[model samples]
Target: MITMQYRIVLPADYDMAIIRKRIAERGHLTDDFPRLAFKAYLYADRTAAYAKDRENLYAPFYLWRDTEGMNAFLGGAGFAGVIDSFGRPVVNTWSVWHAQVATDLSIATYATREIAPIAHHIALGELRDTEHARVQEDVERGALAAVTAFDPTHWTLLRFRLWRNVVEVADKNIDVYQVGHISQPSAKHDS
Candidate 1:
């Protein structure tokens, strides 16, 4: 599977309600979209979380069934609509490793996103092992309801999570998407 996302940094004074409304109205347009795995429409207010100097961001995360699915979405109307509203977004993708979501996704009302540079000299096995362990630990702590870890290229690594409550961690803070409104892969299996 493939994971994709891009962010739009809103001007500091820009009203976020506009973006929130956009998500409310059009975020789920891809619900049953062809080859879609899942899409999470996310928003973050820099003043609310993260370094005070950060800008508000609207970022949507996706897990595609395959490249066909990824290509279709990017070239499809949904993406076009996004560009019309937010301008062109720099799309990023990752090879997914483990994705776990609890049955009640709606409860995932909070989220955290962390992007960090990859350590080029690190052994692949070590990196994978460390990431797997960290994700598992987050789940065990009840801090995360859904999590997806990626083997990143454009970025060293990206970690995103749907959370049950406020996590003390300083990662990017995001508004949780409503359940049923979000979409996920139809079938699940080990990768």
Candidate 2:
């Protein structure tokens, strides 16, 4: 099976009430794509602040097992829109792909190619910034060690974004570690 993770960050000035309403409305409409494994709305704790030192809003985490199907679903869902936050629009979308190991390396190789560009781009922009350098460094070191110790089949792509107003009001920064892998099919593995 394959897994794809998508993350979207709302703008600082976005209307939380309206956004939540819209999300709720769409959630009901997602029945159109029953293949979607999981969808989650995540918010920062009241005590956390934005990493970019801007107002914070809740971040949305979406997951799917059918890569091609999910992409097609999103492409036609009319999910695009702009929100006002802190008098500015600060929205972004990011995605990651994951696939299980089969007898061949084709799946992993394809995922690597499809996901590497976005990962590298985000790493260069957000992860490498001075504000996030330490965290990025730690992640890189850990990721390298993990990859070395285990096969790439166990690895998964993780994409995340930060929202300003949501972070500030919610008083919590975005939490990437807890977003994906929540709905692993394996019952024994409680991801």
Candidate 3:
């Protein structure tokens, strides 16, 4: 599967209610969309934890079954609607490994992006296995509702988590989360 993210960082004083309303009104429009695995409508307030140095952001993450699905959305009216509402967005893509979802994710209130900088000397297999293990750990123990890992291959070792709250282990880490509410699918999906 292909993973995609488009982030729009808003000004310091930008009203976040606009974003909330947008998510509420249109977050599920992509449900059952062709070749779409899922979309997480994520946001972090300017004052949220780990957001001290960042602007309020609307960063929606997507998992597409293939590139065709991604292209369809990006090259269609859906993308045009986004541009009209929030200006041009820079899209980022990554080759994903395993994206595991543990039952319903609608209960999530926070999502975390945990990254480890991978050096050129490290084997890709080693890094992949490590992230896979981490996902299994939380998913098996019911600590996380969903987890996805991917590699962009030149920057950072990346993984994402959808949780009901900030896990205590992440309290001291540089973790980002959806400040108030999360817009995830309510139905359970096969992992």
Candidate 4:
């Protein structure tokens, strides 16, 4: 299976509350048609405390699956990029993992690759104007935890991509897979 990851920086003037509401209301009915695995709007503990106690106000981590269809259902809704309480542009990082080996090592490796591009992309992009922070470290930690904590045997990491816009898929990198990893059992073996 193939999955795409996107990280975007929301406009400073954007409204997060409305955005969350829109997401919940819209659900997975987007143009892309990708299945909604999970979605969260991340924030620091201090910020989270101040946030309105709403179920829609999630963290910065979200997962989507393409099992229902090949395309993601992100019709016209734009990605809810990072925005501060005051609606200022904040650096956002995201990664896509294509389950490759199904083994522990494979999952970990894909996770690392998934989050790595965010730092690189931000550094190469507008983030250069910002101060030096531990964004990379935080993303790395999150990616590590995601892969290590989740256990799946019948998965493989295939293609990884980082994007900002729903229309344009940017910075795509496809991972190599081993041969015969997904072969079907032979009928003769059933006897």
Q: Which of the numbered candidates is closest to the native, going by highest TM-score?
A: 3
Runs of candidate 3 exceeding 4 Å displacement: 49-53, 141-148, 152-155, 168-173, 179-191
The backbone clash count of each candidate, in order, is 4, 20, 0, 27
Q: How high is the lDDT of residue 61 in model 3?
A: 80
TM-score for each candidate, following the candidate numbering: 0.82, 0.38, 0.83, 0.28
Pairs of residues clashing in candidate 3:
none
At residue 116, give the lDDT of candidate 3. 65
- Model 1 TM-score, 2 decimals: 0.82
C-alpha root-mean-square deviation, each candidate: 4.1, 12.2, 3.1, 15.9
User: What TM value does model 3 have?
Assistant: 0.83
**Model 2 segments beyond 4 Å from truth?**
1-13, 43-54, 80-191
- Per-residue alpha-carbon lDDT of candidate 3 for residues 18-81, written as tens digits (9 for 90 to 100): 9889888887677656777667788878775556656688988877778999999999887899
| lDDT, model 3, position 49 | 50
lDDT of 1 by residue, 62-112 (tens): 877789989988888888988998789899888876666665454565666
lDDT of each: 0.68, 0.33, 0.71, 0.28
What's the true lDDT of residue 97 in model 2?
Answer: 26
lDDT of 3 at 77: 85
Give per-residue CA lDDT, model 2, range 1-191, as digits (tens).
23333334456655546545655555445433445544444432222333334433455444455566556655553344323222323322333322221122111100110122224234433432432443344334332101101114433233332111221223233232212112212222222
Better of 1 and 3 by TM-score: 3
